[model samples]
Target: MKTRKIRILIHVAVLGLLIASCSAEDGATGPIGPAGPQGEQGTAGADGADGADGADGADGEQGDQGDTGTANVIYSDWIDSEFDANITDPAAGIDLDAPGLTQEIIDQGTVLVYGRNIVLPSNEIFPLPQIISNDNHGFRVNSPENIRLTISSLNGAAVGSRVIEDYRYILIPGGQPAGGTTIVIGSKASKQEIPDYSKMSYQEIMEFFGIEE
Candidate 1:
């Protein structure tokens, strides 16, 4: 009987152990542990690269120059023929009735060159002799002495067609004025003396004409 009791006690102990183990396995799992603490923030990243520049627009084309301006006196084939009188012959007095001797006509194809001024009456039409050859003649500006005006003929042509066969030259003479500032006047054959501008410098003439320094 004592041996039987001992066996029963051992079985009871083993049963208790098994029950404890089973209880532990059956219990519900605890809530998941809280998430780990957040890590420290990293340093800020570098800025992004800049975008490429836009292409430039095409350049505009240049504009053309304006037309040439018109002048008061323009010489061309359309105008009347030009002719001047030749009264240089002291033998014959001033003759105004000479044929084809007009008061004034802008003679073309002729160039009247002075100190720095090229008085090419681009409007005058040339006759047979477009120029006159006059030497020892004097000129004045505003009737002033010491002032000079020079002239030169471009082509050779007779002053008149009939008896008065004087070849009128287009060459105007040069001279200097003594006082006032102005261009000379009167004909080459005029008995009046012309101003002698030969003594004056080019700058003086330009100044007289009110030209820039």
Candidate 2:
């Protein structure tokens, strides 16, 4: 009975050991596994917030200035052809008021001093006369169409009417030949009676031509 009991105990212990060994061998290693299933994609993050604005910049320096402008000439030239030319107006290029007007007269041309012995302001304009007459102390026939009279006072160099001591006139001989002729009139003021003609201004010249200055 004792031996049978011992054999039964040994057999049970051996069977327990064999079962533990078989369990260890089965858990030790395994064959390579098949590819795993694909994982799900992660969610995207939110965008970052905007930054603050920067400070204002300083002003730039000024640039250099431009150069000065020049003058624009309007009317310059006078009459077209000077010699042997008939002039109807001063704007035609003949400066009638210029000295030696007889020479300026074109060949057989007419010189019309429209207003003769006419009084006007120094700033007023008179028309071109068929015959222009200058009045000094008295009317002396200076040319065929010119007379010289005198003014007691120039009225401070003003162009206007003036009282004189004596006044006289002489008619120009009709049909005077044209090429070049000069008419000159004189006055005998005795240096105490009336003013002289030497003192004249540009305004006076403009007035003689009936121009507004």
Candidate 3:
């Protein structure tokens, strides 16, 4: 009986050890523990490369050529009249040679004559057919074949022949019609009117034709 009681006591000790090793019915979870401190930040990465440039654009088309301009206009420098003779005869007039006056100019083109008087104050320039000191100061195309221009003074008060020092002439290529006219000198769409030079002053005429003094 002493042996059996010892064996029973050994069995009870083994069962208690097994029960402690096996997990008991899970109990209610305990409160969560406090969080740990954060770790130090890592070093920053390098920046990316820049983008490439774009391709160039195509070229545009060229424009058309323009029309020719007024290069045909002609002019003469001031020519001395050399008229020192006293005019006792009203019909007789002084003649001056104008070699630049071509047949085409007299027929299809226009001729303008300007004269400066020696006796006049400030050496005033006057257009032909101007009246001075009660005298009819005028000119006439004597001979188109010879290109001669005649200057005459008529109906004067016997105040010694109105002194004429020099003369000038502008030869416009295109004929000026009876009435004012317009022509296209540039591109087909543009039209410019021809000014009446006879009515224009000497300075105005010079400026219009781009002539130098």
Better of 2 and 3 by lDDT: 3
lDDT of 3 by residue, 21-111 (tens): 7655645666899999999999999999976554666444445653433477777788887555565544345666667667777776777
Compose the digit string of candidate 2's lDDT tens values, residues 1-83. 99999999999999999888888557867789999999998999999998755566744555454221112101111222222
Pitting candidate 1 against candidate 3, the one with the higher TM-score is 3
- Off by more than 4 A, model 3: 1-70, 145-159, 184-187
Task: Please list the C-alpha lDDT of all candidates, in the order they appear.
Answer: 0.33, 0.32, 0.67
List where candidate 1 sits over 4 angstroms from the true fold. Answer: 1-25, 31-36, 53-213
> Which residue runs of candidate 2 sit more than 4 Å off their true CA positions?
23-28, 56-213
lDDT per residue (tens digit) for residues 13-124 in model 1: 9999988887857888988998999999999999999886556774455555433222222211121112234422322222112222222321211111121111344322
The residue-level lDDT of candidate 1 at 129 comes to 17
Cα deviation of 69, candidate 1, in Å: 22
Query: Candidate 3, TM-score vs. the true structure?
Result: 0.58
TM-score per candidate: 0.19, 0.24, 0.58
